[model samples]
Target chain A: MTAVTLSEARPARLRVDGRLGQFALLVPALALVTIFFALPAIYMLRMSFNAHEGGQSYSEAWTFANYLRLLTEPIYLFSLGKTFLLALVTAAVTVVFAYIFALYLWLQRGWHKLVFLAIALCPLLISEISIIFGWWMFFPNNGVLSITLLQLGLIEDKISLMYTVFAAIVGLTYISLPFGIFILLSIFDGIDRRVLEAASDLGAPPLKTFAEVLFPLTRSGIVVAFSQAFVWTIGTYATPIALGPDSLWTIGLEIYQQMNTWRDWPFASALAMVLILLVLGSMALTRRLTGRDVTHHV
Target chain B: MVWPFSQSDLFRWLHAALVTLIVLFIAVPVAVTAVMSFNDASLIRFPIRAWSLRWYLDFFSSSQWTQALRNSLEIAAYTTLVSTVFGTIAAYAFTRLRFPLKGAFYFLVMLPLFMPGIVLGLGIAIAFGGVELFGLQLYGGKALVVVAHCLWAMPLTFMVMEATFKTFDERLVEAAYDLGGGPVRTFFEVTLPMVSTGVISGALFSFVISLNEFVMALFLTTRDTQTLPVLMWLSLRSAGTPRLAVAAVVLAAAVFLSLVLVMLWYARHVRKLR
Candidate 1:
């Protein structure tokens, strides 16, 4: 509430000449979005209805075969279900870790805050591929995880967790953690720190205080964070493809496969469309349910 | 104590333990990668038998790797320039100008940032691939990737600058106008100086996004135009080598170096402003 509202600060000008100039300023952005984002999206949607030929990537005939296959075939159906489950689990786990981390950050002051913030930023600043490479180093039979366990005498022999569902989840959660922490931290900053002190002075147990005081206050933010993380995790293909077993298929990998392996452009577009819908639908539902624009939280 | 948990030694110790684990979860992988980058051996093995900068030398010497590096930098540079300029102006318009369907425009501009790279890549590739404009192929080129990157970059820049401009005091802009400064002069002299940090950070985000991004580039780039991350992804799939580790370190170094330089410049700029 302390933040300045735009309308209060910028009174509308009565002059029409400046209006024209202001409108002109938006032309470049509008043009870029229209030419790149809007047109390609529309084209992809159209491409989804086109016919697929084995020899060519796609043909110019109209058909619903792509959608028909996506809806009916057990393979595509299974991948869709898997993608949703993966995203949900990833988001849930990420939110828990991020909540704890954000609470820890909230309690800290001075240099400790800077240190933890820098640590939180590690995943964000590094490339996704590098994070995958790092884990790629960690999970192999001869990898860091195996070697460390061996040295600690915790395991009889080296074992590889690479290309497993667990490894995939670990990678997914690691990348999504920073985003969840950031969103939750912003919400935490808005709460009065003295509320916790008051609760402690009143003889409330820590668990009871958190359940009654903090949980209810941050419920909306947690929902926003979960939905945001879900939206991001659902669209990603690389981590799962790089880390997971082939049996662990998701819609993103399906899209990549359809485009790259099969060269089935129509099928790929159809899958991409479904993924887009899932993302936008989750975002819309979050906004509606919370009555909060989640975008600004980050 | 500000926190209830601070009153309990048991709770405080438990909290510290959990937070330490979380930090390690975030930090250890990066540490491992940085350490492994110097392995004298080609294979990744712990307790290095030997240590040298052999992989770094290979990364710099190989024509393929160097070409990818150049491509990554070129695309990122163009992406940074295009997105920052377009996004900054659009943010200004949102705050300062009156326009119709403003809310719709704002949503439209931000929508792309929410989209996954896979979908955007496929959409752009299919739509623009194999197409030519003015005797030039639009697909398989750095220009196309720059535009593709702007889909996410411009929106991100807009978001950052939008927040920046909202916090901005419009009175200074009015004062400039009252003092007979035109919109251009006022923007250059008065408005931009105030938001330089926001603009710089936005540009940095754009650059980093384009540099690290691969899914979109994977679809759009030919072997000739492959960026470093795309090259890394391809090379990683083919073989495991310390060279990949070196590439990871090199990429991180690029991002961190820029981040440090920006921080230093930001400090100097703030002092100057003061």
Candidate 2:
């Protein structure tokens, strides 16, 4: 009777442990995301409606003044447009370059492949500040680009590209390029090389082969890469502020200025809400567009 | 063929030229910055008239810079520890367990990774920025930054470990359980040993993510608790100097050093098993 009771109690304990153990494992991660991630986002949403009293951080009052002001302000409107354009341009440029480079990376082997892989990983691994510094040193009057052009007798006077729209785009593109490459490369790796060989054997030109075979094959990947770059570029404040001219205002910069410089939490939270909306919209769009293709492919 | 070239040859030429340009665009700036760190001069001039480790020495010797570095490492260390332990367990549950709302849990875990750092930073700063727990102010503390960093680090670790565990053999786990070993013993002695690579990789990933992250840190940190990247961002805005380049190099070095150490340890571990 003791033996039977012991065996029955042991199984029941194990059954209880199984369910409890799973919850215990999941609880820490769940609590973290809820407290730090989800709660903060909800708080920001609520904070956006608060009024910033004069000479005060904020006072408890419900109003749409922050959002209304963001929409009505001409400077804010311009920044909204500029930020969208900058992100769009960055994403487009990054995807094109990344597609070509990823194709090149895929074709290499052995140590050659390793070298290319390292190059692609550098921008991803290095801090965004460091990348900005690298380019900051390259674009200024006394920087590498000017010096190189001068030594090459390409120009009589040194030209500074620092704090320009062009510089900002270059910096943004450089940083986002690696992500595009890595994403598309992984997709490209999935396709069989024999398909390409078959195309060439059928008397198709390289351009034709790419257009008909490679493009369609990697369409989902391209969309994913483009959206990734866009999302990343939109959220970025440092790259544009550090590398671009004063005229090159982005929503991210506006958010920073509102929060730190103006000491206006309500306005800052409003801008942040807009940024989050844009990111979410893009993500939703990507999911809708790629959902079918991804499922079909998988 | 049109214009004295076959289409394939033309494509090859264009591809080669583009590849070269892209490679240079990616590599040259970092290379220049690394070289500039060794410049003896104060300004960020390219054709260096002198070469010295003055900036490197300056970076290490300066109280503000050294303090920031210490803060970064300390925060990253804590972030790695918390993220790895929790992330691995969560990932194990994801792969091995059958529970309700499993898909929702996975989605919730990954949501933070996709959110903008600015949004995450601002939200946390506003929400818990001033909150005190047990008589300790949470604002401007390393603990806040660790939590913020874990938003990204934890998810990343979970994603990686989930993939690792997906490929893991359940039979090994079954064998351990069938033996006299209990659940806790089986997990520690059997499961953890098998997925050691994933655990190590996830730890390294979180470490690096936390080390380099500054967007969130910028919102959360006071001057005293500022990480190196945050300090660098502030200083870079105010001035241009070889010291900044030294900071970049130092950051890169930290990443490489850990990677090398991990590789060495992994190699030794494998040899011992052999």
Candidate 3:
């Protein structure tokens, strides 16, 4: 990780005495996370090793059977691939669109900017279930899309677009696009508007200026946005099930099925460990992508 | 891939068209949901045959829906309270006090933000399944849901409040101290008011997050303690009804209410604080 990335989230330092008092004050937050966050995670990791017998709870006969199964199991392995693929596609689409939106936002000094901001931020504020429900009404038979298309004479017959991978992609992209927009907008805010003007002044047209002067500067920032979106998208549990078909299973669904339905805690822990490792790896990649960008902190 | 339309009317027209298209794509589904909430149809289909208050009436009269709503409110209230207090104290430490291992603590505190909700939920469920505290088993209840929510809410609170305190003036604090006011008194009189907007904003965010959060709530709550989002998710998986649409509107309404509160605060308090 680079210092630039850290500085974005870092708190400003204030000089004061009584470091002891400060440490004392931090105890409640520390203890809150330690007991509820750290300890439970450790216990989960430990339970992944506990022996399982197709039971709801495992006994304390430490073994690597769950890990071995997670490695050798075809269902688990395939779900991991499917999850990574969907997440990559979703993140890529989200970042591309968000880049355009962010660029437009950076160029504008009008009410259009407020409209864009308000529209982009709505997804972040609403519940994920609500979003899934919205799209649920959107793609299914006689839903809004079909009704609108039918009324417009765009299609001869009423059609349902539900329970498809396309719906899954749309839902995932919708949820992720806001984060991408915010990240890339932060980068756009750092860019000097004069650079584009200079390119135009040098006899380059708009397309040439954008291609030569804008894309390269924003590429690493897009990488950070993409990585963050990918990491976030892979952890989604309800979107696919609610919007996509049953066959469109991801590892997130697998985790829920194992713990909630199948009652297999040990295997669920193994799956969760893999998930945590993947998220951390992607986060590290995000840090590395922006490591050398001088404009990163800005 | 730059287009050659730079000199043509097509360029500007297409740009405007594309922007409008994306806006509709983002807006239409939500509009459909809000419209469906009022649909009198038996199902969640569009082109409403007629509009009625039937679903809304059904939603209001149902004990299950009311119970879920109450549960959501209580859990969110608890989460907001606990997360805000701890997060504010932690923010003070991070912004105003120097200590060893502060960086490590920061990472540890923020680590849960990235942890998948399922993992967080599963971990707590397993670790605390057998927990006995003061002759009570702390599993599968509103209290567990509150604690689990803190994993997400506390870090959010800390991040926002920490940033807010950086803009706070230390001269005022020094002035209070110079006047012979002690730490607690200074904190209440001088420090608290300066950071009051941050506190309110953080608390509102925590509340909204808890209110809308269903991922961890999925694994944490029992049938009796299930939050509105959790109930909505459960119903969405099984029954795709307009009643669920009504529930979504309710949940979205809660968020909008808080959003209005924040906007009001921004108009009244935030500019003054600056």
Candidate 4:
């Protein structure tokens, strides 16, 4: 009877080994990523060098002309500069709001944090397109804000604020704030409260304690958060197109326009290549600044 | 210690005012959309002349809105299933396996998370468009939307689950295995129960992402299979109507509902930990 029981367990052991051996469970994801993500990225990089005209692909004539054009063209260079500026401003605004809100929640005891958390979730859960519509309805001449301001006599008449840089900044900051707060919250949770108390006990002012104690501890987290938000805001297309004025043409919008309207896949691919480089460069800088590898952290 | 009691009241008032202003700033736009959805006017304008559910009624009665909603739901459902399953498996492998190039694999898998959607959508469109596999075209259909969405959803799910798995205790798995359970039995009886919360949250996120995705859906879908966001985009460019507001309200409602569910789940999980 013992022998028979032992023999029965033998197949189970074999089955365990067999299952591990199959490695087939990961095939779907591996295959999907390899095809849809890996291959396409490579193809996009290659296409950036190719020459396409009039919706027709020519031979495999590889050149750096696309990159050259981007450097020489005033519009592309100006848009690149503006995109970086907008991303930087958005990151700064998000960080400030996120830091204050996170500190408030951290200081609070219970349900207050929940309320703030819910508010943070609002922009994150909704579509970017919908958030644009929401802000669009609240900013223009006939929207709620203008109407309210008009009623309260804050302005002479209904004012148009939709197509402004301020609108773009606000929208981007709103959307990116949740991620910043979430990341910083985790970092703040790791900090000990007694450090702040000790500083206070030493007669340090509130601002001094925050600067001298909390800031240094959360420096890496701040860097990570800022870089993440900057990269996201830079690459984002929808909010900028819907909320930004006609004069502001972000690289994202330019890429989209090249593909959809101009049917210039080569130029679009070149623009995408620049975006990819920017993202990679940011990732490298973040890793350097944080003094640790973040790939595993993800 | 200097308590600054003289200025405490002023500080408190300032904090209160700041919080209220920020909350209003965040809430007003959403509130505007919600209120505008009920406007009786065909045009979307402020100072409502009248209030009616006409837009909501129109949204539901109209075939375009209904079909788009249906398509969005179907695509989201499928994308959620595929991403959750694959993501869970990938997460498990990353957490459990001691394979070569593990870090590289993890980075590659998560790379899509940072990639811009426009680039991904364009690449997928060009790669899959007009490509027939055994007499079937994958692009310009719901299948393409599901695939394109997976590019975003899978990475997100993996990242969330990976974080959850890091905090998971491995001794429990060993204990289950030592108790005469096979790997499958151990996983089903021990591991699944442990990570079920993470799985649920991941699924919720994937659902929301697939539903709200616009750029990918715009590129990968046709008129018949266009998701709600794509439909909304087309409609917004073509005309402005209160019915669009109704659709926005509906989308926001769906997102709000899912968020509540996730928060409840998180609350329960916190309680369990306590």
Candidate 5:
């Protein structure tokens, strides 16, 4: 194909022009990105340098005070640490559940596939607020699960699962689960079923076959899914805020508080920059783990 | 077939049970939310006093709820249109171009997707605060909300369409050119049709993201133009009412309907591929 391309492909010059023309067609989009996306980000970076005092106008003086505050403040550092922990736990839970669910869907046939599809679609389809409310109902004192447990004598009294770290984790994991399942399902679909049969014929047990053959092939997918889930969970604001206890303020919630309650634009911008860096760092880490540029071994 | 002594069978069954439990865990919250929405009482309590469509009725009748719903729908529509158009164009450019700084430009475009919504909102809000263009304030309006949403939506749409375009056969474009078709003509007649599924799905995804978005909307929207999710958040903080449940149900219904439509579209596309 490479040898055929340069000489005989002279006729394909028209297609090359077609491709170039497609680039011209992108001018509007490029302009939009420049005006809205690039400009805003640049402006934000500039704003981070501006100096602000308590309830005062931002000055033109470039200062590192905001950055210094973020570094020095225990609250900010603590919130950032908590955000990472929550995201890590959420990613782990999502991957475990998604892997098992994807495996079941892959092994099952016919009607079971439809069942899996519906289950997978629920979290993806429902609004985040609704999901929160659902859990809110399930965890509260008079909520369904608590009430049911009490009635069935499974518990001595109503238990409040709401406003707990566990609830926050559950909510984040639930929200992230669908994307994990979808991406992993695509990976699972790419695997050759006969490989498992061959492994069994070679006297390999099912667990051994999974560990040796299937796991290696799906490693990239696992990395990608976990990273995506982690990044999403880290960025999440509503789930953590609504589900988490008052003590559990994430970086996202802190940013909101800074901007809205504190009216501290500079500090908020500093926090935002930190958030952007963390997200990019996580994405880079995921890419490294997955060896994203490498060819699939299978 | 008679593997009675094999541990694999037990493992398989365990896996199946685990999956079933996980599915149930995921579904229970949604089912509970739906049931609570129909509760007759004013508060969101369990072991329901009775069942009624009171919340749904209240949602429609209340100006606050209806207005928020309208704003949410309008913003979602605008965001979808803007993102879909710009994203498809950008996707085309990325997939087809070999321009200088192409990779850098693409990275810049997608950087916003990695930024958290809170950060994006804060940045935009601060960046545009008191900044007037054309004698009009840029912040705290519908226009700003749409633009803010496009930060993520555009990149998402681009990513999806770029993947679609990568799978596109170059030979077909060559064939079109050989038949004396211009690039624009070929794009409309051939390229668009080939990637219609991707475009539609991407647009739908943008719509859903914009519709369900809360964090950014919470920051940007004023009381007059608050989106549904923002209004819900505000209400949830101040008090827990059945009206909130009603809003949840309405939003859920909209999301579910859109999701089903998209899946049906995907099913038809898969059938066509077959």
Candidate 6:
């Protein structure tokens, strides 16, 4: 009778352990990611090693010609460098402005604070296409900027600000600003409210307080925001294509054109593989610098 | 709250000035879009020549616009369904189970969150471009677009749901089990209802993001299966008109409606919890 009861209990215990239930629950998601994301990425890496045969096909012979060309080609190398630099500048501008906005939001009170937070979240929710075109319309000659300036008699004539590196930078900053602010706002919220008061009581001036207290305390958050912004800006293609001058070519656009127009699948995949590496490298570097996993922060 | 240097008048003035500038910087473009959508003049200009609903009607009437909108809606729907369900399941498994290579699995799962859409798009297109099921090509298909968007949507859903589960009370599940409820019944009657808020929020976020996403869709889809953002992008590259402004407003309307739904759901759910 005791042996029989123990046998019954063993099955019940195994069921209660939930290993089976966990397996059943996790398979669908694991399979989905494996079949789609992981497989595609692996296939892309493999394809990058194959030779592209004009138009619609690839040769079976494996080669590193695609990557070699990427290194040897002056245009491709220049675009990659340009993308990194543009990302850096865009991140700096976004982090600076967003820090100010987040600080204000953190200190404010009541309805206005609610409104400011909601408004700050707008760009984040809006489609990238909408934001690009919104700025597209705003920067041109008949745009609100020029018209308002003209009406105010600040400028004598209309000037189209479209198709400039400055315009592209502004649009990129617009898209990245809200994200940076949200990340920084959460960090700022973590600080004690009295920290600022304590700093002031210690006789530090406003600028000095910001430099010595706020900036230092939130340094990791600042780095996280900057790196997040930089990584994000690198991936985005539409803003630069629509608003940037012809001279301001980036690797994203290069990849798109190669895949779509040139139909060079091998080259495009090679470029994409390089981009993935760059992103991973930067994320690792930032993680080392901040000594934190920022996967959640952004 | 007082500023750190509340005693300094110049500092106060400058801070206010900076806030104002930042507000204007964000607000101006959205204001411009809303304002331009109403322009009677065919061109996308400011200082409203006349107010009209002409472009709104055009957006609804034009096949290019309507087809794109339909495609976006369909893809977003699938993405929302797939991501919310799978993401919830995966999140649960990650939180509850002591799996092998758990840390490595998590890092791999979340890696795509930072990946560029173009890279993901190109990779997917190359990998599955030649494949077919039932003689239907996988490339340029709406289903393919849905899966691509899922790459973006699912990880986000997973993150949110996992965070929510971290705060969840597991004793309730045990209590339900002790009362003789089976696994299935306990999941539905106890676990699900308890986590409905996270599920809803995750679903809403995925739906909205998939709706807005276009870069991947561009690479994965043909003209027939193109999404709104992809169409808008193609046009923006060549020549653009006030019609684009109308598209922007319409797309924004979809996002706003979803936002309202999520807000209402949260309000009702929070009250019930209280």
Stretches of candidate 5 above 4 Å error? A1-20, A293-298, B1-7, B178-180, B260-274
Candidate 1 residue spans exceeding 4 A from truth = A1-14
Model 6 CA deviation exceeding 4 Å by range? A1-17
User: What is the clash tally of candidate 2?
Assistant: 1
- Using lDDT as the yardstick, the better of models 1 and 3 is 1
Candidate 4 vs candidate 6: the lDDT winner is: 6
Residue-level lDDT of model 3, residues B1-274, one tens digit each, is 1222334466657776776777777887689888888889897766788998899899999999999999999999999999999999889878887667867888788888777788888889888888888997688778999999999999888888888888988889878765767667888888888888899988988998899899899887788889899989888878888999899899889889988988898788857756
On the 0 to 100 scale, the lDDT of residue A8 in model 6 is 82
Name the candidate, 2 or 6, with the larger DockQ value.
6
Candidate 4 C-alpha lDDT tens digits along A179-247: 888878878878876676678668877667768888999888788888878988888887876777887
Between 2 and 6, whose TM-score is larger? 6
lDDT against the true structure, each candidate? 0.89, 0.87, 0.82, 0.81, 0.81, 0.87
Ranking by DockQ: 1, 6, 2, 5, 3, 4
Off by over 4 Å in 3: A1-17, A54-56, A292-298, B1-10, B270-274
TM-score of every prediction relative to native:
0.96, 0.95, 0.92, 0.92, 0.91, 0.96
Which pairs, if any, clash in model 4? none
Report DockQ per prediction, comma-separated. Answer: 0.77, 0.53, 0.50, 0.46, 0.52, 0.74
Best by DockQ, which number?
1
Each candidate structure's count of clashing pairs? 0, 1, 0, 0, 0, 0
Q: B55, model 6: CA deviation in Å?
A: 1.4
| Best-to-worst ranking by lDDT | 1, 2, 6, 3, 4, 5
> Per-prediction interface RMSD?
1.2, 4.0, 3.8, 3.3, 3.5, 1.4
Considering chain A alone, report the TM-score of candidate 1 relative to the true chain A: 0.93
Clashing pairs in 1: none
**Model 3: what TM-score?**
0.92
